[model samples]
Target chain A: MTSVLGPLALATSTGALLIVPLAPALRELISKRDAGPLVTRKDDGNISSFAASLRTRCISLHRMLDDCAKFGDNQLIDLSHGSAFVVGQSGAWAGSHHPVALVACAGSVELPAGFQSIADFYCRGNVRCGQQSIFRSLLSEEEIALGNDTQVLRWVHAESSLSAGRNCRLYGRASSAKLLTLSPGCSFERIYAPVIYSSTEGTALNLRTEYAPYARLAQSGIGRTRVHGAMHFPADEEHRGDAVATRNIDLEQGACIFGSMKANGDISLKERAEVHGSLVSTKRIHISSGCFVKGPIIAEREVIIDSGVQVGLPGTPTTVSAPLIHLAPGSVLHGTAWAKTEGRVGD
Target chain B: MLLGLFTAVVALICIYTIRHYCFTVNRIIGQQRHPYVDVDTAEWPPVTVLIAAHNEEAVVGDILTALLEVDYPAEKLAIVPVNDRSVDRTREIIDSFVVHYPGRITPFHRTGGRAGKAAALKDAMAYVNTEIMLVFDADYVPGKALIRQLVAPFFDPEVGSVMGRVVPLNVGKKLLTRILDLERSGGYQVDQQARMNLHFVPQYGGTVAGIRKSALDEIGGWNENTLAEDTDLTYRMLLAGWKTVYENRAECYEEVPERWPVRVRQIMRWAKGHNQAMVGYSALLLRSRNVSWWERFDGLLLLGVYMMAPVLLLGWLLAMVLFYLGAPVGGGLAVLGLAAFTTLGNFAAFFEIAAAARLDGSRARIQLLPLTFLGFTVSAISVSRAAWQQFTSWIRGQEMVWHKTERSRVAPVVLEKSA
Candidate 1:
């Protein structure tokens, strides 16, 4: 009975709980921004800069754009647009032509000039954008082909970024940029433009892709792809084998190349992909069946290679600094390798 | 005998607990401070003030004049008055104001009493283009700062209705009226203050209440069938999950019914109306997903008050009768104790009212607290009449006459319109 009464009291006092915390949260959810970025046209009746600044100040303060106010020297014009971006009532537009890198971990991307249609899009309104801007998803071949059934892909700044004909190469080198890795397959290329490697830090890589007609990489900008990781694999479009320079083989399933693999990071290779940079890690690098690579491999602990392996130049000797080097009869290797006095090969 | 004694002890404990808790919560409500987060009032949207008057010639001119004198943007303030079936010079005054205050005052006079204030308001809804709309009765004389305080809560989007403090203008008229005024303050300023501090208001006071126009439309307009349209509208809004805020800062002085019979009729109509609404709206209130459980609890508690007050009154009379009928000295002492408890309960409510009036800069009324008990006895009789009306209406399944509170003596000091 006491237990029942305790719960009853708590339930009865639930309103006190709402008053303390939930009211503010609810208020935030319901409140709408009164002003957004201003979009102006040139052919307006005589308006002074003072008036424009005053208008901007007023617009910035409203929860929603309503009537324009003319205070002292300022004259405000109400656009009543749901969302807006300030493009300077009069001046140059900065921050354009830069590579738009989107970090999608739960944040918002605001559009300029309280464009109702665009604001409606962000709010998940049913209105579809026709092909005017670079951010609209309709221009993408994948979205067009799927038609009414198009899923919401990665958010884009403009709709102009999608195309199908260009044969592009995945760019980025592995060294210290551990987070840089090519997305598996070519599925996302349709939505997010062609893959271009960028160094997490400042560096250069001479990327040469044969057979692919368009092979230029992004050179600079915030979103420009670069090489960061040292040791990683590069896989072919199809999941089969790595893109070895000599063989042009497709990579195995779930075995896309990763390099600049962080110190404790280990690769679980269902079937190993091609390694393009030096593998420097303190963790085990697992190489499964059908593994093929061409890179300087280094690890602090050990390297596991299972089944059908091909490594290094034809005349290179295999080197190991580890105490023991264990190899299966089926495992093959070719490299200039050596071990320290305390280390041994072929355990 | 043991069971009866045990029940009496339990009842005493429950009454003490409930009253003590209510008083404690009321103190917290009285002391609550609005957090100043530096919200720019300049960004406050333009509001259209709408007052629907029917034969309100006595007060219409003053209300219009006061409205124009408010410290807000003149161009943004639009006073729209709908004169519905006014048999007096109300239309003439409205016309004079309209002509004098061109573009600021818009008067729409309806000759026929087609639907009432609700329908008259519906006709003028199209003209309300601003972000907020404040509604007031003809008998109200709003303070200069009233509009600012009333519209302040619209900054909070969840707030659908804001009820202003309704102080009575005729508090000095008679002892009974003064007590009635105190009672109104206790209900509006004290009970509502406590409810708001607890994050819920049971009902929205009709005059000086500002409502979001969209919310008003969503609730399908006011029901003409209910006697207390304001209460009916408030219940619907709560069911729709919109928050109703009570602003002690916003003030409007309205006329209290001078005569006891008139007051009884007014309260009786209110009691019957709210009772009907509670029965009609219990499911909606209970199923509401938006309002807090406390709001629902308070709403239920308020609806039960009328029934409980009458039952308690009857029990008091029965105890006195039992004492006179050869009861023991101990039983007589128990009846005296109950009377003392009743007097204290009444005083507790009156104390809050006096405190509220004092806080609101109406210090003159604070000295009248000693004679407040005389006013309470008269009010008790009036409240009993209202409860009796509700009981009879419920028993006989009869419709109640919507008694319009007489607005003869209440005069507005300033005209809402410029003229």
Candidate 2:
């Protein structure tokens, strides 16, 4: 028995080396497999780019240029003469050189066409440029004052002190500017450049201004109808009043609506509800299976989007903002969403 | 031959300990990936709450009062207090609540029945007509928002049951209760939440849980013969392709056994029931086609929880015998390595409890974790004795009796103070 035990114990002791590490390895493998998909940081670049691309489709640069042209006092013709050129006021060019310059003396400057000659451009107040519109330095000022020994265009206040090598730069301490191309290398002080529009902060739907009036209208009992089935309204009835429900707005399955709705309580949109307008709720919003909302959905509490439900219109994307947002499996969201707390995508 | 068997057993214990530690560590890491968010819904569904009691007169009144104060629509909520042949004043307290709230409180009196919680729940199921049913033991005191939180998971169609976190109401009463509180935190806050986050099985601990009526009906109701009906039903639900989630935010206060003997009896019952479940459902779980391989593996581990006590006892006994006989258990390095692994396994519980306390913002409770070893030793002894008793009962072909743990009548005083 002693001889048998000695060999057996020897074999068992040697087996510990193989057995000890095997359990943890197996556990790690199981844990890795069970952890499901890795939760990555929400790609802010993708979301901003998507929003920018969608906004670009909504408003074209040509339309913006046309609007700017209506407000420009002096149109830039050519910039082959000097770097700083003034329209009406006399100002000196302070810095290096400007290939093409269009200084709006009286009002703002609108570069409708491509002006490639100007390397550094300055405007007195506002400047609007379209896509493929190039310049070196785009500055907007109230009054471009030229100092002693500075080159100045008479009645055209222009300062050419800042240098522009190879990149495009917008230099100014102004309020707003509508620019077509805002690349990563472009620098600006304070201007409303559409290309750099990425934040959803100021773009959030104003609940007080845009949505509270509907609730007030609902309370006043104007154009309110308890919708039991499908209903269609003309464009005249779009902003007439909200269809308000006191308790819950239960849109039955296959119900279609062409107007907006407001509910003091919860709102449940059943499957295949073809809604063409906004849905405002003071409480929760539950969009059931296969529902389509062509407008924005603003809720004071939670928002649950069921599977196969589509939000946002065809060309125009809307926003769904709430404290908690739950996107069920297979749901298609064509717009932006903001959850103040957190958002759950799937199970 | 004896030496070889002892070595193999110690090696198995080491492997088991390491696996358990790895599971906890992996769960802690996995929690970062999937964080839990409280469910907020617009509409509240109709719910039926069942309180199963057997001679719980001291606590039933307070539990009933707490249930009435839940923050849900009165019209949509239904409370059913199952008086399962209690010879005390439990029926009178339930009747008084029924008289006060005529339609909301529905008293279920079972005079002649199988005389266990499972039998009572099955009997109560006949009267339930709501979409969701929440169960609470007689000693639990649910918060106002607990009902809403408990029923929130049923909104997901795939979820069959939802388990809430339990806190000890008598935690400051004694050292034993304080240790149990830490154990409860380790078990629920860290272990259960990690399992849920990792997609493993999170148990539905008989109390403070919500079950879908249809799901319960589909699983043929609770098994009456099993000692651990919760474990039995948990495995049954997983096999039927339904998910059970753990909601750590949904917390309720429960009274734990403050005395050592009572705690031992409570643990013995849990051990017997859990082992009985292992024996009854291990083969079915292993052969089930619905669950995944990893799920089957985890389910087996969860079922074998009660067996660890005896395994631990055996290891201790073997080490002592080897020390007395002047034999090196393994060589110095081997013994040292095994000791490190065992220490790590033991520390796993402390780590989990500390993390849970930190998560709960109850950082002061973490200082009391060293006292948990007393509770662990008691549990080990009770589990081993229960295992031996079960083995002898099986050998003698005798039936096991359902022994209920006695409750202290200090519940009213605790409730008044909390209120």
Candidate 3:
């Protein structure tokens, strides 16, 4: 028996060493699964999603005003963040940050004074925020009017037309169902509507329309990148194909590009220049007055649209997106204006 | 003669190992380029999503229901579900969706076809009326904003194809699934993305990808003969001077295989189909002047991905043969080691998976990295066998039949939610 024990010991040691190769697999078997959630949707960055989420987890009038009502549903309910005040009458009043204002559909409620709101505000009818008022978010069923020196932290959405006043910071996404207007001295991140008026519409040379005098417009070869790494399209030229450049692309005034334009460096469309397709640039994109882009205009750094410029035709909206967007008083955009960092109303 | 063969094998093996190592390093410290990711507010073009299903009754209805609620404009977006000779109730379910969502879901039922996804997609191409066509498997679940994200790249005329990341739904079902999950992360998060940054090849994996209609027409539609139409289309697009863009942030959930037999069949079919492309276009891709130098080099390497498994297996077999004949095998062990390491990755690497885990921020189950050795060994054998079969069938003038991964769902109500 003692002699047999020697052979058994040798076999057992060999078996144990072989099992070492399977250590990781064994550990995986005994441990809990460590997979992440499969369908974690990303932040699509829209305003309607906020309203949809709130509608799903909503409260009844009875439960919402259960504790605050000494009389009717017009009273204010106390919340964890602050108080929810239901304004039953329509009038201009000084706003408070501690109360979540819920305006009644009876009339428009204008909060033209100053306030800092720490809670989410919901309104059924048209509403206006006060000057220098800081808000988390505002979801209005009707139109919205932001007063001067106002700042919104997350988002603001309205069902009807919306307009912004001077010296306001409309951060995150500000969307309206109809027209959206921005006054001078105001900055924004993203603004969307059917028709967006960034500044006063001014008369300028039209880029979208065909310039007269076919004799002056020579057909451009669509500007090739030269050995020095710059692309320059001669003035009063037209290209039927896309213009691609590895470096800076300067289109002379009155040049007409019927195709897409892409540049690794800055893209400068001179005054009266026209681009019928999208403009994708790695750096800055500046379009001078009377110039127009029919498609989306995207830039990695900043995009400046000077006065009298219109992007995307009415009812057929496009996008002008950049980290910083500067639009002069006379510029207009059809669809969305996205400024990832800061968007100024006036250049 | 034997030494020359061994040297050639070792050279191929070394090339692949070096390729993966470079992928790991570049993805770790490289400037990741997702140029099109920030394109959110564009004038989105009209798109038609094609869902090709064969006996997909268990999962068809939910995808239709989920697709109807996407963020795209109601008038511009449409869904076409191609029913490819399913004897099951797949057609009935698709018809039901058609009745429910009048102009939303268009049913393209094919009673007789060549019996493959490529054939189904080819037949349904006539029904597509939009410039951008997006494909999804019946088992896939897309997010609300996925359609918009997929269509964003077409704004650039140079972009011909667009691909997105695929995440496994039933990840915790068993050990096989957990390993597959890691592989998915590594393939998309590291390898594909790095290729995109370096201006190399980014493959358009059939599902959860978008293709320009005009580009597809130029390439002469889908190649219906091959089992891997996605890889074939990728190579064809590369040769035509068209770019295949990768979007890592556009994550879509899919049902991966849970059982071992199912997984083996999946990889084997991939091997046979991929080698077919390698044989068809390896010379043309290398000699093509339409693409850049980097494109040709990396495109050749990508075409050889599935073939590496069998090539590595052959290396091990050669090492054994040399040992029996008393031949000197100094660098042969290095060859064999590198070959074995190919399958030991989430897709193909020891370091690639680690980088992916770090990038994706999912580090809980990384302890299971060693278990991949076994999974890869099995894959090597299966791939080698399939490669041999492909050669033999080509010599005998036989057609390669299509194989599908069998799937079952435990939850019936959760449509867009992962299984």
Candidate 4:
């Protein structure tokens, strides 16, 4: 029996080697069954990130949940039903951190008095604390900005409490406290300590008009991060010439950027109208009947000459104003036209 | 016992092959190809369309509207609908159409006194004073140019009957409906065409079948004795030295019974009718004076096979057991028999149905091919039920009900608003 078993085991090992050649092809077939193209950044910024763009764009919370389950997303953010939470592993494909770390309300958050900044709010009469310490009465913007000075911190002291807790800690320096560099001999512990914040200057969370590359700071596993207020992009004619080529812009209707469209030419849009493309307005600008551009239009503001009227690329064409422009007898323009005064032929 | 079973199996195989050959050859020559002479559309004979209707309120008006919309000459075309005591608004709708059509329409109402589809049709035959009688079921939606196609074969003097292709409507409603449609596709596309190709184009399905009015009258119209007067008449026509032709292009979309119970009843009725035809026409086998020897013997054998299907299936099972017991090589023979029946024969039919459904420009219906196997199973039940009905009815000396399949509302191709 031992001799037979030894031979059988040897045969099985030989068979295993044969199967190694088939592994890659079988894996390829299985992977191909559910494969999809990787998402990429594009002209349309509505879903700037590729992954979010592939989503069904389902607005309803229930529908979104169903879609998430059906499509089998690696991670899902549940902001649909108002209970904000971030799910899935955090970090990025690179060592770079994922944009979202914490998700909070869209608007301002209230903080207690005496905390001068986000840094001040995380620190208290801190010396050293063990795991699972309950920091009570955290500073809120209302009390902090109003200088009420009533909030305090109470540390929790329990061994088992740390297991199921949030497992998060805030590290920052307080506004009133001096920066203290601890020495090797300076070891301290707070068993049961309560520290109150008292300061005339306090920090308040502000709703800003613009949020920069900060929106990408939120990491998946770590948490969600949000821009409380609207994000603004400031551009002027003098500063806009850095890039000759125009990037296609997708206006998220909710964001409502005034100059929302991108155009290789000058943009000339109708008053109180919406354009979905970049308008490149050249010397000859012609608008045909029943054409709607949902983007920006570009046109030259100085002398430029072209014969094609009402003929332009798809999306919005950039409009350029010329010193003198000629129009056919039946040409009509609806959007904005750049000119010196009463812009027309030979302005 | 094993050797005996083996001998029986070999004999059956030999008989099956010969019969299949004859069936194939007859269909290819007479049914598949242009066996009948062709006639010019300009010289096409006047045709009277006979519509057998029972409680068809939903689609009766559409049928009339479609008939009126047919591109045939008003003088050449005549419509006579035999209203078989419909409790619904079928008669009222027909009457309205008649009032609107004036001279073009003739309505026949069968109120009482011996009610059957054949009887109604026989009574209505008096109104068809034309060379050709194209019979359409209430559910049948005739193509605009169907009359032209059906009559095109009449140019052939020997062609007694021309069978137009019948398709199913409401094919995408459910799995059952889809399967039913696939079954239909299998029949019209594969089975019918194959038989035509092989030479034994079977009897024309009732809907969209065209009969020479004079020939039908000479054979005494339809025989009310059999439930399936269509198959019975077809066999008689062939026996009478008249050739039956199948025209695949002349299309008609017939509404099928979507409900399982209704479908069962419909199949059972068909089965019983076919059985009666077989039993009554079995004598055609012995008498080869009028028909060819192949026609007489092959026709009888075909009918016999259809009637004895359950018996054959049982024999096939026994043959399997005998082969497994190692008494003889019956298992190999059994496998060959099954392979021929399913793969070569039935699979070809399935492929035809799928192909035809697609060619007919119905993508949604083509998707129903996957459920066709289930449809075939259900159909076998109907066939058995039919056989049982035939046996029981003969024993009890009672006739079965002739149930009519219901139709759905058609989508109007031309939706014109009133000025």
TM-score of each: 0.50, 0.58, 0.82, 0.49
Taking chain B only, the TM-score of every model is 0.84, 0.92, 0.95, 0.83
What would the per-residue lDDT of candidate 4 be over residues A1-347, giving only the tens digit for each residue?
99999999999998988757655434433343212111111122111122122112222333433443344332325443333222111121111123332221111233222222211111111212222333331221111121111212321221111111111221211111111111111111111001110110101112122223322121001111111222222222111111111222222222222222222233232212222222332222233222233222223333222211221122212232333333222222222223322222211
Candidate 2: which stretches are off by over 4 Å? A1-347, B1-4, B23-29, B32-37, B320-341, B411-419
Worst 10 residues of 1 chain A by lDDT: A215-224
DockQ of each: 0.01, 0.02, 0.27, 0.00
The Cα error of candidate 1 at residue B154, in Å, is 0.9
Put down candidate 2 lDDT per residue, B1-419, tens digits, no spaces: 54565576667666666655655676556533122232232235689999989999989998888888877889988999989989999899899988888887989989997867898899999879886899999988887778877875553444679899887776665667667877887788778887776667889899999897767877889899877788888988888766688887788888888788898888888888899989988999999876767778878988988887787667556555665665655444444544665566677767777777666656445565555666777888899999999999999998777767788755373443432
lDDT of 1 by residue, A143-188 (tens): 1111111222323212122211111111110011011111111111
lDDT of 3 by residue, B41-91 (tens): 655778899998998888887778778988899898989999989888999
**What pairs collide in candidate 3?**
none
Error of 2 at A98 (Å): 48
**Alpha carbon lDDT of each predicted model:** 0.49, 0.61, 0.77, 0.47
* Chain A TM-score of candidate 1 vs. true chain A: 0.26
RMSD value for candidate 2 = 18.5
- Tell how far residue A257 is off in model 2, in angstroms: 19
**Number of backbone collisions per candidate:** 68, 21, 0, 98
Error of 4 at A273 (Å): 85
Give the per-residue lDDT of model 4 (tens digit) for B216-332. Answer: 765677877667778888788877656567876566766677678888777777777777778777786467354556556556765665544454454557656755865455576
Model 1 / residue B64 / CA error / Å: 0.7
Q: Which is the better candidate, 2 or 3, if ranked by DockQ? A: 3
The CA lDDT at B282 in model 3 is: 94
